[model samples]
Target: MSTNATTAQSPFDPDKSRIGRVLCFAAHPDDIDFGAAGTVAAWTAAGVEVSYCIMTDGDAGGFDPEQRDEIVRLRSEEQRRAAALVGVTDIHYLHERDGYLEPTHEVIRQVVRLIRQLRPDVVLAMHPERNWNRIQKSHPDHLAVGEAVTRAVYPALENPFAYPELAAAGLEAYKLPWLWLFAGPEERENHFVDVTAQVDRKLAAIHIHVSQHPDVEAMERTVRGLMGQTAERAGLPAGRSAEAFHVVTVNGPGTIAGF
Candidate 1:
């Protein structure tokens, strides 16, 4: 497989892999846009189908208490608009409470069902482990989502008997081959996508989350700076941008029956 010039040997490359579909899981509406919208845009531009599975509506978000009752609807709408900007329209909302997500059995089963139904070639999710250097990225909801999706991608989704009701409903067991964990600690990052060309697209998508950002311009600058730093670390050319990830080969050559 094509590997980055700066990264170590790997089995798959985002540019060369026959990745047809990608399913992304996030704790809130804006999470995906913040973490991986540039990569999503690149994939869609390459003719891959991308979908978002938001675990929460971000009901507890927004700066004003007066908007609490309307936050859910507002955030959901914003996410749809943001996704559309990056060529994604398929979205699944689990409606799990914001600020209180957990890797419960029901949540795992829900994720498993989606995996079976969509049968995506790759799944991108938040990092389950906390990043001590960047504590904000390790939101409780994000960690829960990562763990839940990780569980679903393993024996649960591939085992016919794990969630029998899903099979009864015609969603058969699926073997997801690859997973990408975002917002992880620096040392664990094994993949970096040079997103310089798609940075504008990513910024446009992030701008859609107006309710979540009090200063859009400042947020854009910060995101750009972060991406630039990531690119530098990945040995990309100066002025380039990138999004990093910890890739796991779920059902690939190295793994043994999804172990």
Candidate 2:
């Protein structure tokens, strides 16, 4: 039940939470790949079903707006390919206008419907806290999506009375109490799934975002470099290339349900 960030190198283990269905919510096409692809690969390899829910179409993500529609389409295709690489079959795009995502009731309801229908065991989302001082900090879209997803994960999905029409569709009330919020203010993560065996697969999956290949490739190098630095800072072993996460257990005494 504690809220803290932890590195991927930690020996901490999660409980046997059946992770048969996982839904990763990201603001844009590349967010999930950059933030948690390695872990996604690990989960998929273990037979966990993984899906991506991108909040935005990423129209404002590219360098050119003249080709906004085309860019969005291309980005979506890239995301699909990337999902395939990671063994995910379903990819849902909200197509919300890029760069201006607000946590509206409508958006929350939509996410809630997906949660109910998918019945995901694990939901991965960005940290919603704002960092005004850090000008180059997290994107506003990311923050908004995080907030909406968190709210929806609780009341929206569990309360059958919340969205009546969804219940009519046979999407019954469900609760996904296990959540992993990345890039939180704190840096002590609670659960760390070993991605050492799937690091290369992660890199390959990341490479599928051709529109961002250059920048992502550069970022990959930086991440690899930072791994050593992070280990030094945390006083852990060196040469560790890991992705960090802040886990939030909404239920079950902080236990992961599936293996």
Taken over the whole model, the C-alpha lDDT of each candidate is 0.89, 0.73
Across 1-259, the per-residue lDDT of candidate 2 in tens digits comes to: 1112244553233543456778999999878876688778877877788889999998887665565669988889888888888788799988899899988998999999888878877889877876453323378898898899989887678878888999999989886767887655535454544455566777777787777654775867865664445435544555555566667666566444331
| Clash count (model 2, backbone only) | 14
How do the predictions measure up, each by TM-score?
0.95, 0.84
Candidate 1, residues 1-259: lDDT per residue as tens digits?
2223245344566456678899999999999999999889988887889999999989989998889889999999999999999999999999999999999999999999988889999999999989998898999999999999998888899989998999999999888889999998888888888888898999999999999898878998999999999999998999999998888888876667635
Runs of candidate 1 with Cα error greater than 4 angstroms are 1-6
Global CA lDDT computed for model 2: 0.73
Best by TM-score: 1
Error of 1 at 81 (Å): 0.5
**Superposed Cα deviation of residue 105, candidate 2 (Å):** 0.7
